[model samples]
Target: MSQHPAVTFRSAAVVLALALGAATPAAADAAPRSRPGDAVRSALDELAGGGEFAGALAAVREPGGRGRDYTAGVGDLATRAKVPVNGQVRIASTTKTFTAAVVLQLAGEGKVELDAPVERYLPRLVRGNGHDGRLITVRQLLQHTSGLPDHSKAIPGTFFDNRHRYFEPRELVDLALTQQPLFPPGKGWSYSNTGYVLLGLLVQKVTGRPIGAEITDRIITPLGLGDTYWPNPGEQRIRGAHPRAYKSRTGEPGGEPVDVSEMDPSRGWAAGQLVSTPRDVNRFLGALLGGRLLKPAMLEQMKRTVPVPGAPRGWGYGLGLTKISLSCGGLAWGHSGDVGGYSTRGGVTEGGRSATVTATEKSLTAEGDKRLDRFLDTALCAGQRPAAGQALR
Candidate 1:
């Protein structure tokens, strides 16, 4: 029941779908393919055709190659506009990976300590009902083991009702502080956007600059991610040509859908507010897993994972990245994100093969989520189709 829309989509159903079995064929014509990107495209086509999303876009970069892009459905359902192949979309919690990267970079520079208590940087700021900064380490925050309740879940409202509201990072943290911690720090695993808000505040306190600036200077700029950006306060429109976003009426089966493409994103903040294109997202994951974002030691530390109690089997939570053991054989590292009108999932393999897929709809039905996973698995496990009844790791 995390407030973030993405967390709702990450419920047990999606986890189980990702953990077991091969891609279930979307239709009778959906069959295995031999070409490089054909299987991946088929997966996208299946998702788009199933009527869960207005459109879908996917970008894939093979090892030592220029990459390919695929699109399915319409960008604008009203006008039947084709989905932009490299359009900008709100990359929700995936922003956590970028935030974690900046913090880890600070750790490498001796400016921050991963194991130090959060109080070491933001004293008194974390104190509240059953919550304490002294016992929570920076690593705990990055890894979602801080036990902080997500502020989004604490508040109640629809995207349209709160679109114009601006939330200070401290304000959001306070909302969570008003509630008891889910568990003692590091004693359990639970995703907490509030923990990342604290991390964002920590970055500002240490650097005397907004966390967005730190990410832009340290990661985005360095990687030449021209299409990625942190939207400023009150900015509700996505820059450049992009697909419109939609959300289910009540997030239930057959709920009415509405356009949520343009809404204030300040509420998401450091927790899940980044806007990026599929190409940029794929490049970022590629650079991150390819050892361009952090030092070897820090990157290894980031990869050290803990079991996610409710997540799918063979999946674990690392600092910010999610590690999934594919049924087709191989490990894929990346994250998934959800905001009001967008849903995105992407990953990078050890071989440098990377892919990112995005849909215009924010909340997906369980079956839709399964189709999305099938798309990701097909893309990442290209050419290595899993055999029938092969055990999924």
Candidate 2:
């Protein structure tokens, strides 16, 4: 097997220090046991205290309920600025969920077939290294069972030295083609950014427009996600009031954190390049689960899950979304994203409650990851303590 690094963080923590100089009105006097957002704010406070994060934000909205926002720490460590309450963030691989939603919508419209061979649209682009385009289906691509290697790992120096370089979608796919397949198509499950890149190409082929435009027209604009956007090529910085992002020196333990807020996002392309805020993310997910994005059949198909053995327990891959069993005893649907200088996890419960939590630091230690997971679990569970012996999933 190839040694490609996993795109998501393997683990995360929330330090117990309160980094915000002043508490927000939404968080000041509420008890976590009484309010879900209060619980999330408490968790964020814990994470910011350990010095692992420069800043963090959490936003939650419940059905027929008032929305609440919470924040901890400073936006910039150098300047000691507060993080913007609803600032735009890179949002990394969460873009896949949006991409998959668009593709599934096309399937509903009869513009594309879910099980159709990718060769039908892209022709010979997927040919190479024991990979056959004729055998891989569009469903497999969105489900991440196409056996394709991640281009980020397949190509050396794609992220570090070329952080500012812009790449066409085809070029990114070509890099993955240079590596051997991880497994025959549909034989096993593996996360492949290249597979999603191909799906983006297929979307372009069918729609005659870039994936960004389709996502904007179908998902962003319709859902009223005003703060969400796909950055244009050569656009290297987040556009709104936002916290600075930091990456560990070489993304390893004990390395100095470096600011990486200005890298070009084209390197992530359709797979992971979209930028959004916690509130916007919650709104999108809420609308999705509320049946605003896809037709009934297509939405059900998106939730059809397969076991992800390499991921945390109770975690399953379904189209581009993740089905996670919460510690408080229920299923939550959403995705997690990690890229240079940022890490995010968010989800919506079946009853229409949504929450998103973000950290400014990219490279998280094991403890940090656990804390982040706990925050997600605690927030979604709606202030209900996890059942005894139950842990964050």
Candidate 3:
């Protein structure tokens, strides 16, 4: 397993202190609730203190198949808007989970074979890289092992100051093609927004429809996920009432903490463009894991990949879904999303109980990611006691 850059125990201690220190008052808030509710509430409070996120909203499905919603903090900072139990926000990479679902649906219909070579559709993408772009498969792209670079640079720096601008999907793909291959197709794992954008294009080609249309026809409408949509820059503004996402410009060279409530969908494009509420995320994930979406055989195939030890969820792929082991005695199948000023983590237990929390903070820094994972862990593992670390794998 590739370890994250080592942090000295002292630094870790400082972070832990910050996390636990924030938890104290939250724990107090939960004192009036039942143990399970208290656990969930405590976790939400700790997550809210991280400067990047404005709020955390969650829904945990019960064994009897009922779901409960929990929310904390203000959704929008300037207006002090409370995050509605049904408030929608940018899903970022959580859109991958939906993307994967559509692909799996196509696979089931025999429209696209997961193992087929990509040369059939995108012949020019890998032409000169000493890599057989033909060797790249849909499955590899979904699994993040396609050896493609994360064409984030495809997004112009100027757009960072004005994230509400739109760019065509072709423009994003062009940026990816300009970069060198990170590795040969199927050789290793690297998170590549580029691969998914291509996958989205393939979905368009194979289905003879836009990716958004197919997702709506196949997944969203059927699931009754009324709050989810594939939005664009024109539709960038946060609707109804929700948290205003903030980005840390703390150490950025002459940058101010930017409010990111109106970020561009083109920045994420197909890789992270979906917008949804916490309740909808929970519903979609829970339905997927509960065998409501994919067939038993296909679901098994999706869960068949290798596990990345010690990561929150051991890595595996089927379509866009990922497998993760919770600190509690459960395995969750879902995806995490990060884009501009939004961060989302959501999953459904193997048995179909689900939990999800979305925050408005997005940062590449170690501290930021750790904080996100901690909040997700708390939401997913709420009632259960922590298990031996072995289960984390």
Candidate 4:
């Protein structure tokens, strides 16, 4: 089985969790300036001007305790519904952060083992090619070191074709397992949605409950993040005011915007099914890293994984955690999530100063993703006091 405390994957880098701490309450200052907001807004403006992203709303906080909110462009093309700072767009892969939290909570309860082999619970999850499930561990799945290929077979068709339908967790897992392994377990790292699908399965196997229930009970309810939710088909839109989401095929190929209100939530499931606002995400991150979620030992154990070459640096996985650096002063621990129509990054600083930013456009191209990171880095690090000679940008 893959070794414990060694995170060799990008998605499940749990070691990054160490960067998070207590949740600082919303800043005491008067209405914050739009500088931080503009940092992100300007980036989205550039993207939209170039016909890359339709629009985005970003919320950022200062390490010294200030916060700003920004809304740019329209949420929908035809309707002209202005994007709101509290937009309830689908968080896509950002949901994995919550999933990871539930898994870690289970581990803390002694119901799950971080380094246990996957076959110990989900024996039926076969690792295609010459690999076996026994060779993979729970940590490997969370860390994306399970060597399983992404849900390629299940995507570009299943998800795209039936974009409005709900997919059972088993269906996605089955589709992913049909693919060949990318490498021997723990030999290297790759981002795999399949690993997270299996993790959802493990949650169900051990708890005998749905992934939604587990998250609600373990993370949501306890934290009292009432605004956060995993809405069903009949209940898609954000409860009150929210930014409407827009979708287009691309710039050159240019297609009319789609409302995206009726998109499928099941395809993402435990992996990326969440729809939350910056306030809620920030609060959750604060509580999670503020010593409220897991015991010290369990939290440290979950944080033992980090990033390596071919993968982003500063990544580690305990359960479903991701550790990222500020490149300014402190580090942050949380997940970076995405789906076809949305992209999200949210994490709290080592002192619980947290931020969450989300966009409706895919920005899937290597170039676009990189640009998005630049925007995120600028917005996230703008308020922090520089560490030593480090530059904010």
Candidate 5:
């Protein structure tokens, strides 16, 4: 299991959540000017202009109560327009944390039970191909221990092939049923998009409302994340002054960039389909870790970590969050995600430091993923002393 940082809450980080306290009016400012985080801005510039991505956006809050929004590269490859500061982008799997938070909140309210069998809520909906709802618990699904096959396999072709197709929640789950299980419930771990879809179903079953609305009422509005929102069903275009997401022609980093920002993200429902900005994402994360979103007991449950096999050393998965070791010191707890045309990575430290990066294209190679991790890690550890040779690029 990943180790939690020794630092606790009630620190400066909680200060951010107190005022809906981030993403200012200057968030639309043009690219970097002479100021703090020059290194962070330079790093983002290289990533976007170096042929790895068409554009990138970031929001970083330091330990001393200072924060800034940054943009790099072009927003639209066709126009060569500037990237919007703190632009909105599809947040992908990070939505898992929102879904998990609602489930945990429901569990806290006695409306749901963490250990209850999936069959208890949805009743046989999760049966087929060695998978059985009777044997899977709510906790298992939230934690990716349900042994369910990922429904992404059911998406037919590449993401571009069905950018406009809408998928029903049950239809996605049934698609996973056509596949085999990864392991018996609670016996192992694997990332399963299908499991979170079941969670969406459970939330609907228990609350009698759509999962998106639950997330909005329970989390977004409370945090005052004005730049964030759940995309309505069949919602294809991003709703604000955001950067255009790009797809690589060869499906690899450095390949020719193609615009693919408009997409119907039904395939990622309950697992990955929310739109948000770096500042909004940072604010939401800080609020979540600050006790505004869940009761203390439930937050603890969200912090419990389990080993993620094949993940980097010191990497672990919690209910819907990620606990990863930082370069400066200690650990950061947040999630990273990818969708059709965007990739985002960020984390809030135990001490209140946080940073988020949104690249307009996904990393198609392991090396590219590492570069993204390195840049975000560099941003979080900014203004701190550097190691012997690990200074920001």
Candidate 6:
């Protein structure tokens, strides 16, 4: 068997902390629901109590920059520990937004051309499985229209079975090379971690620095996102106080939640390996939307979007960002992430309000995902006043 096989992470978004299924009744919160942000408080309680997750977290920032954090359920099942507000969780494919932002910054600097062929930097590296580096543009990789098959689809065994495996970026690319392309480059839209892996390689090639360092220097440090960091090679433990993440006892969804928090994340390099908190992620989103990360022209280019097949109605994807239509009207842009043992979902409004919802499990039932979406939507629109929603609950 191939060593350090792929692990499942929905590069687009996992179907969230709960899997798609029927909604079960969650317990009601004892806290008064009439106060400011009480809507989000109750939502977290439901997510923890009846959503079948071990814990949940959310951080809300208003248009004027005020922020509030909330948590529910236990951090440690064994100790019955309280969940830390704004605790760090594996932000999964949301890392794509960071990678894409850095690339856009490079594009703005003229160091990389968005329309240039991948061959320009990583020549011959993407050849195979009906794909050619010469024909695929750097844009296609970020946009996920390169027609590459996802290597994570082929990861073998349960998440626990490969907890300590270390994988190189090239190794991840090699795994995808063995599979057939989904279609000719740019002919369609598909989510492939393989494309992001190539993008990561391209970043390193052009910057003469590790992709992680590029992200840190260009994005993380500049924005003061102290809670975010790329894991060093072979590092597995989360660096700060965080709730233990859980996996089903049988290594499948819908069983007892087992502590599955610590594991090597090399398999998720570039595509889904960063650890961060809801507050930090929300800050990043607001700064990005406020045009702090990319020049106006490149930011516009990033927002120029195409339809995402199989996504909810009116959902569109821009470079690495996702544009979701809120029920209260207008758009909220951000990304969602799901790694085994943790799931995060939220978005930021163009007006600068944002919310991030996280769960401490790899599996969130279908109903749970929808509930979280409602919670996010409520937070985005409930009190903002500029749009159909309010500021933030």
Q: Encode model 3's per-residue lDDT on 186-220: one tens digit a residue.
A: 77666677777888888998878899888888888
1-393 per-residue lDDT for model 1 (tens digits): 112211223532111122111221212122223245566766777777877888887777776746777777889977888887578889887888899899998898999999999999998888979888999999999888888888886665766778768888888888888888889999987778888898899999999999999999998999899989999878889998789999887886567778888887777788888999877887888888888889999999999999876555667778887887776776788887777877787888788877788877745765666566667777777677674553332
**CA displacement after TM-score superposition, residue 281 of candidate 4 (Å):** 1.1
Tens digit of per-residue lDDT, candidate 6, span 72-166: 78889899988876778888888888999999999999999999999999988988658799999999888878888888766777667877899
TM-score of each: 0.90, 0.90, 0.84, 0.82, 0.89, 0.89
lDDT of 4 at 158: 43
Q: What lDDT is obtained when candidate 5 is compared to the true structure?
A: 0.74
lDDT of 3 at 266: 73
What does candidate 2's lDDT look like per residue over 328-364, in tens digits? 7767888877778777777888877778877888467
Candidate 4 local lDDT, 170-263, one digit each (tens): 7777777666777898887766667777888899999998888888888888988777887764454556556555555442235655556556
Clashing residue pairs in candidate 3 (N, C-alpha, C atoms within 3 angstroms): 75-243, 76-243, 93-337, 100-320, 313-324, 313-325
Task: Name the TM-score of candidate 2.
Answer: 0.90
lDDT by residue (1-393, candidate 5, tens digit) is 011111101110000110011222344465447356466767776777666777788888755546777777788878888888777889887788889999999998999998999999998898877888999999889887888877776669876787789999999999999988878899987778888899999999999999999999998998888978889988899998889987777787667777888889888889888998888787778878878788899999888988765555566677887777666666778877777677777688888877888777733454455567777777777666755444211
Which consecutive 10 residues in model 1 have the weakest lDDT in total? 13-22
